[model samples]
Target: MDNIDRKMLEILQEDSRITIIDLAKKLNLSRPSVNERFRRLQEKGIIEGFTARISHEKIGKGTLVIIQIGNLKVVCHKFEEIVKEEKAILECHRVTGSDSYFMKAVVSSTKELEELVDRLVPYGQLNTSVVLSSPVSNRTLLPEDEFLHKN
Candidate 1:
């Protein structure tokens, strides 16, 4: 993608609901040009479907937990199938290294966390960590990222 395409992505990340006219103004391009680029971006699959960010705390899922599941060299799909049905699981990824899989989940209380742990115990050995606080999280991505820069 060109600089203009990159800029469009950066702007869209901030506010997906922005109108084509407003986006055109921000990018200093004509409405037709911006519209075409936006359409092309979607067609290319670079811009995935839009989604709303739900607040875990407000939704009664205040506790965030990271889970590492190991020793599932065979029958990985069995574990995957179970987690897919869990509403608490936000992300589950297959990773390289000592861990077979990594997952992020949210719970309302420790009781709920324990219940979740109980259900998954049969699949593999799990190493779970409860998050006390997240100083940096859910940051936007860019083609050229300056992750540490405020501006």
Candidate 2:
């Protein structure tokens, strides 16, 4: 992607709902050009999809837990199956080091967390921590120009 594409991504990261006209205005390009660029970004798989950011607390899932899983008796596919069945697991990462997987989970209470842990114990060893507060929550990705330069 070029500089214009990078700029478009930066703007869209801040506000995905921006109109083609508004985006073109910001980029100082025509509406048709902006629309074509957007279509190309999607076609090239540079822009995956758009989504809303929701508050876990507002959804009655205030309690945030980080779980590190290790020592798997079952296959990776089986462990993944168990994780998929659990509604509370929001994100799961295949991590390196001592841990096999790192998971972010949201629940209603400590009781719920305990229940979730109980279900996961058979799969592997688990080290869990309840999040107090996040100083930095979800930050958007850096512009492609900045990312490329830094690397």
TM-score of each: 0.91, 0.92
Q: Using TM-score as the measure, which candidate wins?
A: 2
Over the stretch 53-149, how does candidate 1's per-residue lDDT look in tens digits?
8889998999999999998744878778888999889999999999889999999999999999988877888999999999988677776545324
Cα displacement (angstroms), candidate 2, residue 11, comes to 1.3
Q: Distance from true position, residue 106, model 2, in Å?
A: 0.3
CA-lDDT, candidates in order:
0.89, 0.91
TM-score, model 1 to reference: 0.91
Task: Please estimate how well model 2 matches the true structure, expressed as its whole-model Cα lDDT.
Answer: 0.91
Residues 1-151, candidate 2, lDDT per residue (tens digit)? 6788888988998999998989999999999999999999899788999999899999999999999999987988889988998999999988889889999999999899999999999999999999999998867765556664653
Poorest 10 consecutive residues of model 2 by lDDT?
Answer: 142-151
